[model samples]
Structure formats: C-alpha cells, structure tokens
Target: MNDFKQELIRYPAARITEVAKALSGDLRVRILETLGDMPMGVSQLAEALGVAQPTMTINIQILEQAGLVVSSPGANREKICYVTCKSILLELPVKTGDGLHRIEQIHMPIGMYSRSIVRPTCGMAGHDGVLIGSIDDPRAFYMPERTDASLLWFSGAGCLEYLFANPIPPGVPLDELRLTAELCSEAPSFDMNRQSDISLYMNDMPVGTWRSPGDFGDRKGKLTPDRWFSGTEYGALTEWKVTKDGGYVNGIRATGTTLGDLSLDYSEPIRVRLEVGKEAEFQGGLNLLGSGFGDHPQDIVMSFVRSIDRQ
Candidate 1:
C-alpha cells in the first residue's frame, strides 16, 4: 500500500504542532466548542461552565495565539471571543482526485434605518408594489418591502419575502451556511418580557429562528423618528442561523429541519423570506432599513457556494 503519511508530511510540522497543541487541553477544547455557535464573553463562558474567569481567559488566549479564536469588544465593554476556524481536514490513505475547490461568502454590510416620509394611514410598499406590505400603516416605513424601507416595526406576527432571479443549482454539496444581520429596537426595554422571534425560509421550508430581548426604546432616536416618536418603545439586536441539520438564534437551537439540505443555486431564480412576530402574543415590531425599500431599490442579497467538506 502506498504510504499516504508522506503526503500529510508535506504540511509544515510547526503548523500541525500548533493545531495539535491547541486541541490537547480539555479547557481549550471546551472554549472552542462554546465559541462554535457564536461569540461569547469570558465571564459568560466561565459562568456557563462553572469555572473561574482566569481559567477561561487563559484558555482563550492560547486559542487566540494559535489562530483558532478571535476576540472583539462586546456589549458594555466586555471582550467578546469567537472561534475563527470551523473545520480541519486530515489526509487519508487514499489519494484525492483533482477538482475545483470553491468557497463563496456574501455579506449585506448595512445598518437598518428608514428615510421616506409616508403619510399617516398610507401603506408603505416596495418599489415593485406587488411583493408584500407591512402590518401597521405607520410601521410600514420599516417593513423590508422596498430597498429604501429604512424603518420597520412589527407587532403580532409578520412575514416579508424577496424575489431573486438567480437560484442555486439543484445538486451541489453544501458545506456551511449562515445569515447574519444587525437588529436593534426600542420597546418594553431590553428585558426578557420584551422579546421578539425571527425566522427565515426558502421555498416554504423553515431555515431557523432567533429569539431576541427587547431593547425597550430606552435610547432616544434609535428606530422611530423625532416627529413620529410614539410612546410605545421596544428594540433588539439579533442574528438568525441556518445549517444542514437545523437552525438557531443568538446561541440557542431551534426546531424544524433535516439533513442533506438543498444547496441554494444562485444561477437560478431564488426567493428569501423573513418572518418576525411574537410567540404567544404580539410583543412589538421590527425595523428594516436598506436600499431595497425605495423607488429605485437594490437587490436583496442571497448567496450560494459549494465545498469539498460536504462531499
């Protein structure tokens, strides 16, 4: 049998040793696992694992030095940390065939806020005018309808769908998929009582859901305009995730999904739909601001790519 170890040896010994050393310690492994889903502060990780803050800090530092972890400023001056690497590939006994290896990532790097002045009682619609509408008349300004809808509010349950001409190819092995967007609200306050649930879908299939704490329109001029300032306050910062098995929000797992999920084909016609509402009761609404809300809106971004890991 041909020795495949020789092929593996081609990788620098220092790099391999770094990867092994980072994985050798149980504490380091735990820290990496915790960061797999989302970024967390040292205090939160320590509290969750029932460990000392120093222990968590030490392990995280090691991981960071090894290039396995990344850190940034968190809410309220806390240092937030997240895993930078998702997977590792090991050389096997068999020689792999030569083929194309592609990795694609799409990001909608914009904040949410509205601009157009809609008349009171007048419904805000997208540039298309036939896509969808918001629940409340005043709230319509924030709906994800037009590329220009910078302001959006959702009370009870509401759904918005975006149409795209390019769809994903039918049979491509999918590696990892995620949908990230920034969200914040001013409402019942940033407490548990003031909460909102968000979900994503494709072809009517549920992708994932995230429950966010309301920001209780505490800070002035976050969502509502100075002129339209109503007494009702609510807010939240949220991220919704979807994978082959299922989905999650913040860091909690949500139900509904199966394995071998279809890979979205960007070359074909595609549509992405978002749903936001209260689980038991109408808690509050959401604000979506982008070029898509105006008379001449931009495209609602959707991305699809293939990888060898899935195969």
Candidate 2:
C-alpha cells in the first residue's frame, strides 16, 4: 500500500524468546497475514477473524509489544493497526572455542551529540515524542533536556558531532569498525520524493556520503510512540564500515580512506560527525532516529571487532 512503510527487521538471539512468544499463537499469525494487505481497526479485524473485539484487541497488544504491529487512533478513537515489518532476520550468537570477548559495542543516544549546528526546520523530541524546546529554534538544541531526544531533524545544511569513549581494549588489534544509525531525508509533513546527500566522518577523517531516498511518513514505525503523529515516521538503516583496506557503506567501497586513516587512539574518545554540506547536490535536509522513534530499536551503534587470528 502507498500509505505504509515496510522493511526487514533484524534481531539478536537475546530477543528470540519474545519474538517467538508473539508468533506462537495461530490467531496472531493470522492477524499479521490480514494486516499485510491493509491497515484495519480492531473491530474490523475482529469481524474478519470471527472473534470478539476485546479478544482482537488483546492479540493486537501482544503483537504490538513484540514490534510486529503498530497502532494509531482512527476515527471514533478506534485503534487502527498496521503491519510494520516485511520480514525478520534472527542472528544467532557464534560460539568461540576460547572464552573471550572479541567484539566491543556502544550505543549513543541521538540528543547526546557533542555539537549541533543546524538550520531551520530543526528540533528534537524526547522518547515519549514530546517536544523538548521550541521547534525550529537552533537554541533548542542546547536545552538541558535534549539528552533525552529520540528523534531529531534539521533542514538545509548542518552537522551533528558525537564523541564516544574508546571501547577497544589495549593491544586488541582491531579488524573492523562499524557505525550504524537510522536516518532519512526531512520535508514539511513528508515527501516520498525528497532526497538528501549525507556524509559521515570518523575521528575527523572523511568516511563517505550517502543519498537518502525520501522522508517517510506514510505509516507508523514499529517502535515509534503512538502519541507521535509527526509527519516524519521512520528511516532507513545506514551503516559505515572501515577495514584495513578501505571505507565502505553497506559493504560497497565508497572511498579509498582506510582504517589507518581514521587514526583511532585507544587513549582518546572517538569522534563521529554526520553532516549535509552546503555543496551537496541534493539539499533536502536530514532526519535522524533513535531507539524509541524508529522501526529499528537501537540508537547510534558502534562495534569494534578484534582480529580473527588474535581472537
């Protein structure tokens, strides 16, 4: 449907039990199948499935909790549910012959940026989707409560920088470093046709730039709060990886910049910057999503993997 956003969802083994419990019931499975075609009200689903409205509501809540369904208020205050994920990818943990930690990860919240220089159409919202300060005010970014932001947007051109504490252990010999975040373009209300060129930098070294397809608001996000009816809903998950050979975006080489160019220092914090330069061909702006406001339930994540041989 034109009014829905669907994407594959990836989960780790730790969440397998919760996801499995949600799909264990036959009725819940049928509900997902039905919603796959269209969004439906609780009463509508109940009628189609030959069940009482209360029963349907209960099942819907279960699916919603598991992030399989997202619901919003429809006419007459009725709850309308939409399927949020096209598929699910479960990643099982690998067993290491020797007991040791080979990977280190850190999650950074959106509002925790060390510096933000944004233009108009800029603002941030807390995990509950409530505005932290006056919308479109650059000074709003400096608010003390901004640290709780789950969603942030800016127009024209600007940059958001973050400083993360180095997580690599001393003399670990890193093999690869990865950074991932949910992001998209920004538009008034929402425009599927909008596009934006966004760039990323690691420790002041240029990583690469990516073109965002559009500002998606057609449907609610799985983890997005129901109270948030803002035009922007969800974003695509973008990742930047650095290896000894070069820098890549989504596994495709984007630049000759190698991991060595990053000049990562274990004794210092890591700096990350996401920006839309004034010279960008597509100046549509940018929207960044955090754990409580996107289809993916994660914030800005950085993972450092140790060398295989050393592990």
Candidate 3:
C-alpha cells in the first residue's frame, strides 16, 4: 500500500480508465496481490503464477503502465517489482460543491471524420483487422465500414477531423479540457526511426504539437492483427490536457494556448482535428492507433472535465 505515486497524484479523475484496464486482467490482479507484502523479481512472479517469463513480463508491463506497480533494476540483471497502490476506491460521479469534479468522455471512431485530407501511404483498417483498400489511396478512408476502424495510418500532409457533441454542463464553465489517443510516426514501411509532428485543434484553432520520436516497430502491438505486416506494430498512447494556463501533453506543459483560446462553446458540436502539419519540422507521417493497434483500449477519447457543482 505504498502508493505514494497515487496518493500525491496531480490528477486522478483523468486516469480512471487506465487504472480500470490494469485491474481488468485476472492474472495481473494475482501478481499484484502476490507482491502485496514484498517486492519480487519477474521470474519469481512467473513461477508463482505458473506462467512463462515472457507472459509475466507483458503482464508486469501492463501493471507498470497503470501506475499500480513499480520496477527497478535488481542485482544480477534481474528486475525487482512491487505494488504501488495500497487500495483503490471507486465512486460514482458526485456533485458536492467544489470537493469533486466529474468528467464527461466520448470516443470517436477513426473513420467518422467530418473532413479527411491525406496523402499517399494512407489507409484504414476495420474491426476485422483488414485494410479497406490498397495503401496510398484516399478513397479507402471513405469506405462505409470505416466506422469499424481499429487503426489508421497516413504519410505526407494529412489529417482526420471529428465532431463531438458538446457535453459541458449548461451552468458549469469548463475547468479542464483534454484529448487522449494512441499515435506514432508514420514510415513507408516499418522503419523505426521515422518521426512526425502531430498537432491537435479545437474549433479550428491549434492547441499544441506532439513530436513523435519514431515509427514504432520494436514489437507487435498487444492488440495488433496477425495478418498485418511490413508496417508499424503499434504506437504510443498520448494524453493532452488544456487549461487556462496552457496546453499540457501527458501532464507536461506543451503549449501556451489556453482552453479559452480554443473557443469551445455548447452552441454546436465541437470540431476536433488531428493533423500532421505539412510545415512541421518532421513530416514523416501519422499513425492514429485504435483499440486494436495500441496499448490503450480506447479510440479517439475526448474529455470535458467540469465542476459538477459550479457555484
């Protein structure tokens, strides 16, 4: 229960889904319980769970990602791990003056874009993990089944736009605005060195830019399809939050543009755009990961964090 990380967490409401996903696995839960009283190595956990070392590693990674576990280099090249959360309590969204905030979230499928401008080296995949058309074809993005896309990627100057029904409470001014998505740099094939400057816009105003380090190909994505090949295996799940001060990427300050700068209002559906600026220093491409192609289990997730009892 040495959950110092969670105890002093700067943000909690925003991470509920990640924590839930981590606790969803039966085996992961067992590992966490086994490490309750003491820290152990990967091999020890595997032996205790009667699973292979690789399987244990993957499960441990998920736990680490959720911030429920911590791992450090042990003696003799072994990795020591321990539980980070003493306890977890789930609460229904409550309205009690300023003590609590409720977050409203929605997911947008990859192909539900209201506007799509992409170049060659682009295509969409459905829930079945099959490509809608040949690469370098824009028409593939318009396929009817695109609503089922579990993953999407593109290169050169490109972007996919989406609309979200306004969820801001009538009387509550937004306290924070955020967007979460799994993405990576796009390469012609599987080059791991590719990079891209991906940007996000609200109501046609730029909020911030995230510089993707590379087109990831280190290993196959946890949910990636077995048939897909010669391309990226997956990408990184990034979170961007905007407030009065500015825009933050994964909790780090990224831009000076504040939420008010985006001009979001309840009068109409919010216009959300994900794009790779052609003028960006790195125009490698864009890989918008979906449920089947990234570590996260969500599509384009947008959040409107509002004070339930704005007084």
Candidate 4:
C-alpha cells in the first residue's frame, strides 16, 4: 500500500504523460466522471454503463495508470474504484496590466470562531467607516487590499462595514461593485421558514437586499466541512448587486434598492456596507462564515472596477 501511494504521489511529469497516453480512450473520461462522486464496484459500474465487466475493468486500469482513479478492496473482497482528484486549478497564459491591473486571490478558512453573539456581526470596515463584512455588525474592522476575513457576529438589526483605501482615481467612472459571502443559521435548534434579511449600502444609500433562508437546524449541510456539515443545517452562496437601473439577485431584476440601486464613484473612496434585519414577520438569526466560521473558512472577495471609457 505504501509503495502504491508513493508511486501515485511521486510520479514525474514524463511518467504522467506516459500514463495519460496509455489511458487516452474515448470512454475513459466518462468513467472517471462517474466515479468522481463516489466509489463503486466494477460490476455496478459496468451494469450502469451497459458495458461488459471485462471491458469496464480494462478502462478502469487505464484510468488508474493515469493517477485519475484509485481502486481498493471492498465488501466481500470486491474491487472498488474511486476518483481522487478534486478540481483543476490551471493558470492560463494571458497578459494583464503592468502594475495597477494586478489581480490578487486570497483564501481564508472559516469555522475558527470560539465565541460569537448576535447584534454585532463580523464584517470589513474601512478607515473612513465603509462597512463590508456582515449587515448586523456595521462597526467591524478591516484593512485595505486584504481579501480573507474572519468576522465575528451580527444580530437582527445591525450592520458591518469595510472600507477600501485604494481611492478611485479621479474622472474614472466606476464599472461595477460585487460582494459575496457564505451564510448559515447560527441557532442551536432548527426552524423552518427561518430567514435573515440582508441589505447592501453604498455611501449610506440602499443598494440591494436579499432574504436568505436559515437551515432546518436538524443536520449539518452537504458542502460544509465535516465538523460543520454533520448536523441538520442548510445555507447557500448568496449574492446581490446594484446597477444603473436597479438591484438584482442571481440575474433577476429585483425591485427597490436591494443592492442594485446604488453606484460607486471611482473618483473617490469606495464604501461598502451590509445590513441584516428581520422581515415584517419572519423570525431567524444568521451565522456568517467569514474568515472564522469553521475549520476551513472563505476569504470574502470584493471587487471595485473602473472602466476605461468612464475615464
């Protein structure tokens, strides 16, 4: 087993190419994709794909050689094959800006909070009081150009803000502003119909608002980490925005300043804020997974762009 693991892990680029060439069959990609989600026996895979067991085994061997799949002994000593690769992070050969057009990517782990409470959620705030973290914790502190964040908490009626010090160059028209965060319910108990109303503000004006649903509080979510996803809970990747016309969510035009109603003036500092509150009759609280939600938190990504035509 050790030799097998080492051989798979320490393969040189030339060896990898040789293995790829060996497995370059038409049905190999489909077989790998099917096995990527879970492990399965050869008989089961062959039956599902309407192929003979021997034929399936031949393809599996090719995939295993390519280091794209792994096989092990299963129940009753049957052979089980599974995919080991998670994702493909590739760097494209493209030219960007010299200095000012640099793009920075940062990753922040969540689930590191020891203690969190409501009424003051975690968020990013600028030196000039622009909030960016969560809505309830409007006074959260943040630094400029930093992407990953570990915010604390937020309540029913509060806001979190983040400020970007990189001033918008004068005479440059702001092209777009976007904000995204993973949200879940913080309650110990589950409640259906639990909702958290969030709003985005720019320079103290309403930009957009999104109503997020809390988990059933019964079990953890599917995509969350093991420690966090084990319980009966639910959350989602929520985003909203403001445009020249109005606010929108997932592309649908939303009425009111739900986030799409405001615009940024690149000629000055960019201020972003998040507001959390209860709808007229809904009841729920939010657990914001910033840089401190779980064992593997997410770095909140915020972008402020200025168009060349606007300049």
Which candidate leads the pack in TM-score?
2
lDDT of 1 at 25: 97
lDDT of 2 by residue, 137-167 (tens): 9999999999999999998889999999876
Candidate 2 TM-score over all chains jointly: 0.68
User: Once superposed on the true structure, which residue ranges of model 2 sit more than 4 Å away at CA?
Assistant: 1-100
TM-score of each: 0.44, 0.68, 0.67, 0.46
Candidate 1 lDDT (Cα, 0 to 1)? 0.50
The top-ranked prediction according to lDDT is 2
Candidate 3 per-residue C-alpha lDDT over 1-311 given as tens digits, one digit per residue, 9 for 90 to 100:
33333443332554566778888999998998899868899999999889999999999999898778888888898988987756666543454222333777788876788888888788887656788777678888877877788878888768889999886645567778889999998887767777789988887777788889898877878888787775777888888888889888888887787877877666888888888887889887888888877667778899888744456
User: For residues 17-92, could you state the per-residue lDDT of candidate 4 as single tens digits?
Assistant: 4455645676777786667567789998998788999999988888776676788898998788877665432233
Question: How much does candidate 4 score in TM-score?
Answer: 0.46
Q: Is candidate 2 or candidate 3 better by lDDT?
A: 2
How many backbone collisions does model 1 have? 42
* Whole-model lDDT values for every prediction: 0.50, 0.87, 0.79, 0.51
| Model 2 vs truth, CA RMSD | 11.6
All models, RMSD in angstroms = 15.0, 11.6, 8.6, 13.9
Off by over 4 Å in 1: 1-145, 164-172, 184-193, 220-237, 256-259, 262-267, 277-283, 289-305, 308-311
